[model samples]
Each structure stands twice: as structure tokens, then as C-alpha cells.
Target: MNNLFDLHLQIGSRRARQHIQDTPLWQLKQFTRKKKVPDLSSLEKFERSRKRFERKDRLLAIASLSRFAKLDIGREKRKGLPEVILAEGKLATDVAKITQAMLKRTGRAVVSRLTGSQVKAVRSIIGKEAKIEYFSRSRMMVVKSHSYTPRQSGGRVGILTAGTSDIPVAEEAEVIAREMGCETRSFFDVGVAGIHRLFEPVRDLLKWEADVILVVAGREGALPTVVAGIVDVPVIGVPTSRSYGFGERGLSALAAMLQSCSLGMAVVNIDGGVGAGAVAALVANRVGEYRTRVA
Candidate 1:
């Protein structure tokens, strides 16, 4: 029979790289010399013993990941996104226990909404050797970068914001998109207060050929509609707070954005940066896949 890995038009199983094993002649020779044992022609029994050892090892690995400290390690394979830990209500000691167990099982852990006190508590429990980061503006703490390197799944998604105050929301979206393995570009501090700046930078953003646009704005919320009118790609609108007086803390912006006149536009909840990034990532991935198929 031809070798499965042969590239010279060899017909083999459906799997090109099937796991094939050669006889363990060297191992048998060493065993015989070291133990004064006789060489055997009983190949069937030797094969059975080797396969038994291999099966035991595989089962052990699976059991290690199945119920390691109440963590579902199999989730890492089933869901493209890693399991996340919320630090909002759990005790620091319990969080540490959970995190360390997860790290042992999966080698990566993310805890969101990490406060100063909780950060201190987690550090104390982890004994100061753990690597964790605090995203100050987002009020989140992340154990950045998992064990396996994540691939870039989506093409570039252009990010835009109405004003400087909207940067926090924009940053949150950027973080989530990057975490989702999508290429991102941002045009910040371009608001309708100076329509000239908005039009010009937005024109530049369009020139870059974005797969999708995440337009984050506060107050009036007219930026997303205007942006959608100009771009052919899908526009995702995220309305934030930081607006004064009648803005009612982004409620007005949310209302305005939802009532947008432009077509092919979608709006997430108020200050829902994660929601916006999830939608953008999906669109960006689809566009990338479609372009690849066409090319």
C-alpha cells in the first residue's frame, strides 16, 4: 500500500495524514538487551499492549479537562470565544480559586468588571505572580492572550466616533473586536459639531475599504445616519453617554440613532460596546470569507 502522506498521486484514506505507526523494533531490541529478554514473533500481543497504553493516555487527558474545579474546559473547543469570568459579585478568594483552576485547565482566563478592591483581593490570593491587567476606562480586568495564539478571523472594520467623549465606548469596541481576531482602524474625535472634520475623515475611512463601520456617537446621534448615507458597507451605531442637560445621559442619543433615516444601519443598546463589536465581527468575518471565495 502507498504511504498516506505521499504527494505523488498516491491513493489512500480520506485523511491525508492518517496516524500510521512503524514496528517498534528498536524499543524491543533495547528491552531485550537491558532485561536479558528474548525477542518474540508474537506481534499481535505487542500491538495490543501499545494501543492500550495510548488509549489510557488519551482518556487521562480528557478526564483532566472534563471537571477541573468546576470549569468547563471543553468550552474552549466548542465556542470560538474563551469562557469569561465576571468579577462583579463573586468574592476575591472564590474568584482566585476559579481563575487558577481555569488557568490550569485552559491556560487562559478573563474576568470582567474588576474593581480596585477586587484587583487587590485577587492579587493577594494569586500570590503576586499572576499577570492581569486593568482596563481603567472599561472597568474590566483581563488575562490577555490565551495559550494558543488566536488567528485574525475578520478583515478590517473601520471604527468612528462622534466626539472625544465617545472614546471610551470606541475603545471598548476596539478591544472586543481585536479580541475576536478582527483587524480594526479608528477615526476618533470627529463630531458633527465640525461637519467639515467629520466629512473629511469619514471620506478617508471609506477610502480604506472597510468591511463594516462601527460608528459610536453621543448627543444628537446624527453621525451614524450621515455615515451610513455615505458608505456602502453595513454601519453599526453605538450611542454613548457623556452628554449634558437634556441628553439625559445618552437616552436622547439612543433614541436619535434608533430613528435614523439611513438604510443598512443597525443600532445596539446604549453604551453596549460589546454588543456592537460582536455584530461588527460577524459582518467582517462574512465579508472576508466572501471575498476569499470570489478571489
Candidate 2:
């Protein structure tokens, strides 16, 4: 009986050694090493997840004002231009709400094409939270926090209107450019009808070192082409709906600008004052940034 028991014990020990040899070295060593603390692994995973979430949040940095609107709060950070609210079709209450939310996020709100009711609603809703400036001619409104001051980009923009009727569009561009921190100099009623009226303003803009020029015109829209030919800087053409008879409502103006022969001229859609201004501001700001870096 004792011999049998010894043999059985030897057999069991042999089987255990065989199992150890069959196992991977890493698996065998794991048993001898201290067991990994689950807490550390979990913490590392949590940190990785947190970083991923932060990246996604930054990419989708938008503010939802209920379900009516989602304001692009990250616009200014991503593209040097702030998000502008168009109040043309939206309800006054909605516009006011969006303006409030935008002000809360960026401390500045620009609303374009605001009707009288929309302006009233915004002023009433915003109350003491911000100072609102209404441009009656352009039907636009600018809201700013009391402590906010626009940082100058040291960029200059020159704006010209073909006629008195085009002043509203030019004013809209002026407001947008100025809000973007560019100093704007405007000359009104400088159309090709009085071809000589264009030279003095062009000379003045050149003297002022204007980085970009915006020409707001209607009817034939020949002003931008003329300005582009004379000026070395970039010229953006903004056509307006200020014509009568054949090719009325700025169709002719848009066509004329698109078919311009000038080399340095770019054309925007009919009455696209906001787009023109934003583009002009972008160019001016780039020049300003370059100047800053070199200086």
C-alpha cells in the first residue's frame, strides 16, 4: 500500500510539471508576479476616454437655444469670422433668444436684416445684459457686452458705393468689416456715370494704405471693374437690386460683375453684403497678422 501511494504521488507531480512546461512563459511568470491592480488599468482607460471626449467636444462646439437654433459658438475660433444671425425669416422671439445665447457665449452678437419688431424684441429680451446698436440704413443690429472692446487688427478696408441707392449695402459691409476689427473708409455716389468721381476716393484709399476695397454697385455694375483696373489691391464687387426696366432686380448687375474683365476683382451674389465684408475682412486680417508677425 505504501509503495502504491508513493508511485501515485510521483505521477501527480510529473503531470503538474508537464502542465507548467506547456503554458506560455508570460502566463507562467504572471502567476509569480504580483497581480495587476484593476484600478490602474481602469484609470488609464478613463483618461483615454476623457481625452477623446474633449477632442469631440471641441470639434462640435455649438450651443443649442432650445430646438429653434444651434448657434456656432466655435466659429470665431475656427474661422476668423463670427457667426452672424440672419433675422429675415425667423420669428422675432426666436431672433431675440438666439441673440441672447450668442451674447452669452461670445459677448457679441450681430443680427442682419432685422425688422422693426425683431429689433424691439431683441432690445427688450436682452435688457441690461448688453448694449445694442441698430443701423437703420442697413437694418442690422450689433450687440456687445458692456465690458467688451473690439481689438483693432490694424487692417484698413475701403468701401465705395456706385450711387445713393447702394449706400445701404455698403453700410452693411462697413458694419461687418468694422466689427471684424478693420478700420473702414467709405465714399458714396462714385459710380461710372460720373467717372471722374471715382479717382479722388481711389487715391484717398491708396494713401490710407487700404488692404482691400469693396465696391457696392447696381445697374450696370461697371464700378468694380473700373476700380480693380486702377487699384493694385483686391476689389470685391457687391451688386444691389437698385435697377429698373430691362434686367431689373440686379440680374444685369450680377452678370456684369461676373463678366468683368478686371484681373483682381471678385464678385459676390446680388446684395451679398455680409459675404463681401467677411471676405474683405479675412484678407485684411491676414495682412494685419503678417504685419504683426514681422514687426
Q: Name the best candidate (by lDDT).
A: 2
lDDT tens per residue, model 2, 169-245: 99889999999999999999989999999999999999998999999999988999999999999999999999988
Per-residue error (Å), model 2, residue 54: 7.0
Q: Please list the residue runs of candidate 2 whose C-alpha ends up more than 4 Å from where it truly belongs after superposition.
A: 1-57
Clashing pairs in 2: none
Compared with the true structure, the alpha-carbon lDDT of candidate 2 equals 0.86
The window of 10 residues in a row where model 2 has the poorest summed lDDT is 1-10
Error of 2 at 29 (Å): 35
Clashing pairs in 1: none
Question: Which model scores highest in TM-score?
Answer: 2
TM-score of 1: 0.68
TM-score of each: 0.68, 0.81
